[model samples]
Target: MSPLISSFRIAIAAGVLSLFALPAGAAELSKELSTAVTHAGLAAGSPDLKMVQTHLHHVVNCLVGPAGAGFDSGQANPCKDQGTGAIPDAPADKQKLLLTAAALAQGGLAETDLAKAQAAATATQAAIKGAE
Candidate 1:
């Protein structure tokens, strides 16, 4: 295989391995977060949703894998690293939005939190577009 293809395979393998290694709680959280993002993406029809989803997946891999593979892997935290050294001071509405996304990424919204889920989906769309 070409060098690029080989590298891609290695990365993919590493990501998969990482997911399997997450601590149960972190793995669960990551799953919820990933699900939320995916649902939101599908709802929003935003192309940048793919990029956000990829990043969220990497977060899961990092949590489950060797050191330097998860969100705390020295790379800035995407959720908190929104161009600020500190976690951005998102408004209550935005916090709900992110929480909903994280929840959805981890698992489907509970019936009571469906509104939050929709907000999260919207926030994800806006966040991705702003990043671009």
Candidate 2:
């Protein structure tokens, strides 16, 4: 290849890679956190156990984003386009809260009982409320 063409190709490749490497910005992370809290609240207030689980799944989806583990395509992504994943995008100081919230949301997913799931949802909300 000509030197100029090789250099152009390298620049294109670097630009593509940079897009994936950059972390979510503050505005995107904030939107994700707020959406997660809303999903948790919805789970807690759901009338049926199935709906509770569904909403809890939404919370998990929001926290983890499409690329993170525990993301469920079956559940709607409330935080889509907000960030890569709330936990992954979170600042170092705020990661703990997002992780706690994610754990609570996972627990809610595992719960068979309505009350237990609701409790988990409430706990999930509390854990992330401060970060939002």
Candidate 3:
């Protein structure tokens, strides 16, 4: 397979695995984050909206399945599991900052929202500078 196709297959597999592994409540949070990012990108008129939407769709699909059914309210409540736990309540501020960066990247707002985008990007970049 082509490198691009291979990469896509790998991503799809990972997303499926992640969804199956997440606790019901944590899965909802993940879906919410994906939705927020998509909406923010749309609001920003992101040039890469299609790519962002694809990624978000993959995420939601992986977490919620093909049916697109979101977690029920009770199942969506906050609760963190140990080790492989889901962050039931995702940190709102951090998610906002990350979503801002995603919007800037997708919207190509780097040129238009230069200062704001840069600042947000810098902060988001710092937050994930190192990872395992």
Candidate 4:
């Protein structure tokens, strides 16, 4: 194989292996989060209701739920008003993502923070795609 092709293949292999290394709960959460953010990014790119809703849903189910992957962070949920997850003061973008996710799960998808959520979701989706 050409060196470039070999390197690309190796990188892909590494990424796949890394994904497999996540524990079951964490893997599920990551997969759900990645999928939700990808969907959100495609909806409107910014302040998109679809994106916000999807992100929120996944966040609650995967990160905030009792069986969630929240344990992976070893930190309380920063976005939670009174619980543990990431931390309340995580990066602004990250905070938006987590807060929106929580809100979506909490049935409070207000329009006020949709922009932030959209940005967070889009950025996260971009990062995941870049990894691929």
Candidate 5:
């Protein structure tokens, strides 16, 4: 192979490999917050209390991340690759908003009534959006 062709191939190969090499916790905090918002909206729109609780749990899980307090291991994290956790990864100012969203999500999880859970979910979504 010609030297120039070999150099081009090496560069192309390096670029391709770099595409898959995302650093640990490289996902932006906004992505996780948005994911939390999505789950919260889903919870708010749920037709039943059980589904509301389920989606709320997802919101909490995403906000808190795997290592954060209130993170539930049993619930699926919709923001798994989107950052460590929205609350922990957020900047100081935005952390407060995420924390509020987390509290609302936790509250929604504790509620037994469908209306209250839905309300909490709506509030949680709003709080997360506030950080944006």
Candidate 6:
């Protein structure tokens, strides 16, 4: 298989594995995080519009999913401005995503960066009341 195809497959597999790694009972948090991890995996393997878009959505969701889902952190909501939801629809958001995708496509993110992103997601989820 071509390198792209191989990378895509690897990304897909990584997503599936992430789901199994999550602890039970945090269904809501886990779902979004799993999706984000999946998208990140895809970008790491091979960047593309779809993968990057999805990656941003999930990453943002990871940071804001609890608030969007109404977890009520009490201190201050991370995704309060999100209102109903947050999708990368704005022109600027799109451009940023495209740029990120291109950069990732050129060369996947560093392992440390990926790990930091993953850790951020976990911390964000923990911040939400009842999300952990």
Model 6, backbone clash pairs (residues 3+ apart or across chains), number: 0
Q: Over all chains combined, what TM-score does candidate 4 have?
A: 0.31
Deviation in Å, model 2, residue 53 alpha carbon: 0.8
Ranking 2 against 3 by lDDT, winner = 2
For model 5, how big is the CA root-mean-square deviation?
4.2
- Say which prediction, candidate 1 or candidate 6, comes out ahead on lDDT: 1
Off by over 4 Å in 1: 1-20, 46-97, 100-120, 125-132
Error of 5 at 60 (Å): 0.4
- Candidate 1, residues 50-132, lDDT tens digits: the string is 44344444332222232221233543243332212111223344445443334333332222254443444466545433322
Q: TM-score, each model? A: 0.27, 0.79, 0.27, 0.31, 0.79, 0.27
Q: Candidate 5 versus the native: TM-score?
A: 0.79
Clashing pairs for predicted structure model 3, backbone only: 46-107
- In angstroms, the error of model 2 at 129 is 0.5
lDDT score for residue 85 of model 3: 16
lDDT of 3 by residue, 13-101 (tens): 99989877967644555554444344333333334434333333322222223332442223222222211211224444444444433
Comparing 1 and 5 on lDDT, the stronger one: 5
Residue 51 in model 1: lDDT: 40
- Candidate 2 — which residues are off by over 4 angstroms? 1-24
Per-residue lDDT tens digits for candidate 5, residues 1-132, read: 999999999999999999898555435676787788889999999999999999999999998889999988998989887778888887787888888889998999999999999999999999998987
| Local distance difference test, each candidate | 0.40, 0.89, 0.38, 0.46, 0.88, 0.39
Two-way TM-score contest, 3 vs 4, winner: 4
Once superposed on the true structure, which residue ranges of model 6 sit more than 4 Å away at CA?
1-25, 48-54, 66-132
TM-score of 1: 0.27
lDDT of 1: 0.40
What is the C-alpha lDDT profile of model 2 across 33-91, one tens digit per residue? Answer: 88888889999999889999998888888888898889999889988878898888888
